[model samples]
Target: MVDQASRMQPTKSTSPTPLKVVAATDLLARVQRLRDSVARRAYEIFESQGRTFGRDLENWLQAESEFLHPVHVDVAESDDGLTVRAEVPGFRGENLMVGVEARRLTIAGKREAEEERRNEKTIYREPCSDQILRVIELPAEVVAGKAAATLRDGVLELKMPKAAPAKKIIPIGPNMA
Candidate 1:
């Protein structure tokens, strides 16, 4: 039997961070992009496999791994800005490239290939390289120049301040009667 004081309790933080939210439209677009890329790659894989049947799932999984596997991100919106967190394991902060243009955010990275040599003799060659390039269309307009990003523990977090909505003024027609 465990007493109340003996039971471990979860630590509470003072700061309140809102839950991440991805817009439906953005999610749909991302899915569509993934589907298109995956389809194309899968078709290529199928052709490479001599147009074999009963391997639809295998082809799709391979295509997904090749084309749509990296830079998975979760986007959240707040009154002040948009927050984007991306999972980028096995990558260093210096290897990542984050950019914003118009209403789009792009995340890209590459892993260098490795080669093994024995006594200056080429024995084995392995290409375990990977590249990730993902462009996300923001739900709301943001000031690209003011964006900030940080990479820690294989995760990238970005904050982009929302752009002020455009304003227009109409001339009064002398108080139309």
Candidate 2:
């Protein structure tokens, strides 16, 4: 009689034994991981691009705002007069206009650069911008007609004499009537 083992025929396994199984699973996982990484990279790129765009837009807006808005100033007063001091570098009396209306004083003028100086490219131009428009409002009563301004040594100074306060007259009930 022939033994059962001798009659059996060997057949190859449909799937890989052990080593190939792990490799297949690893490959699938790696592919999925690569897809996730690509997605993340795309998101990162988009976010950074958005930030850059926003920063550029903000810079432009800031410049526009500054151009539209009025220039900065320092307004102060003294006992003798309403002294308005403005920071106007490279300015002279000719470049500033100070007008006092009632208690409000307005300073507006453009600093015109000498044609000869604009052409010369210097290392440092103090307040390269030669244009200025300044308006100052007084806190107290000011003598508009007597107001005078002097722009000297980059400081626009306005001398406004304060008006004397009017006395208040209090009226009482007429003789207890």
Candidate 3:
């Protein structure tokens, strides 16, 4: 018979895989596509509303909601490092990922829904998912390895130390005509 301790021993993986890095150009293209989709949806909404004057902001907000679930974020700079705060309710620390690569900061989160009775009749349902993704180019370089992130009270905060800015010396040219 196998001993209890031996049977309860935990197993470890033999190998680990590295993470993939997304190109900046690809990120930019995805953002552009989202923007275009929002614009088109907003225009359609305006037309559906009988082309009423004013309410541009409302239309845009509606369009954005349709295009993507919004994740409010605030970025601040300090002497120590840059801090990013994001409001992501319905998500726990395990559901979020914050990383910096190629001078770009990426924030991704997802909240999975529990299984429910599928055969039951449903009255009204609003599609919802606690997923959020945003990629932003940092104004200054950052130390990715030293970065830290914390999630509290449904808010996610990240602190990253900034790297020295690149310097360039240009020669003075003769006065232009």
Candidate 4:
């Protein structure tokens, strides 16, 4: 309880401090390990979900895989441009309308069948040209302004030019003197 600092003579204080150095390679390896762990965990989740939804996935794949009837449509792309061809079968002029929104293309049209006597002996009946209203969104942006559609030989063909790549800036000299 005595006032030691006020009464006693001052002396120099000395102590040895601890220091440590860490290698950059060790830190990088630790970060890499952490990243790998997270990736592995993500894959594990995907695997579980894939297993659980296997049936639904299979059903969807199968349904989307084939063309069941004449109403089916096909889409193909080449270096020249994009081509959308649909099997309209018997659709007539001015009845089918093609629309383009942003990058999506839609075809909506009605197919009419002339009315027949219901009481008469029914030989047979088919689609009689069913209505076609198909809309597909493009994977990338398209030049919708220059888009064109034509129906020929019962196949609706849509020719679209893919969006041009952005141009680089051309630096100009500063106007200031």
Note the clash tally of each candidate.
Answer: 0, 1, 0, 0
Q: What is the lDDT of candidate 1?
A: 0.84
lDDT pick, better of 2 and 3: 3
Alpha-carbon local distance difference test for all models? 0.84, 0.64, 0.81, 0.68
Score candidate 3 by TM-score against the native. Answer: 0.51
Model 3, CA-based lDDT: 0.81
Flag clash pairs in model 3.
none
Worst 10 residues of 4 by lDDT: 61-70
Q: Of the candidates shown, which would achieve the greatest TM-score relative to the real structure?
A: 1
lDDT tens readout by residue for model 2, 62-176:
3333344556666667776777777777666766676778777665556655434656778754553444444455688987889877767677767788888889999776795
What's model 4's lDDT at 22? 69
- Model 2 alpha-carbon miss at residue 105, Å: 1.3
Ranking by lDDT: 1, 3, 4, 2
Q: lDDT tens string, model 4, 1-177?
A: 768776697767787686576699998998787656545544444464564653554333322322123256777877756888887777876888888765798776776687678669978766454545566877656788888988888888888888877799999988997
Which candidate wins on lDDT? Answer: 1
Residue by residue across 1-177, what tens digits does model 3's lDDT show? 999999999998788688788999999999999999889877877998899979889778777864577678898988768888888888898888887974788777767776566889978766555556666787777889988898999898989998777798999999999
Cα RMSD, model 1? 11.7
TM-score of each: 0.57, 0.46, 0.51, 0.45
Q: Can you tell me which runs of candidate 1 are displaced by over 4 Å?
A: 1-66, 113-122, 171-177
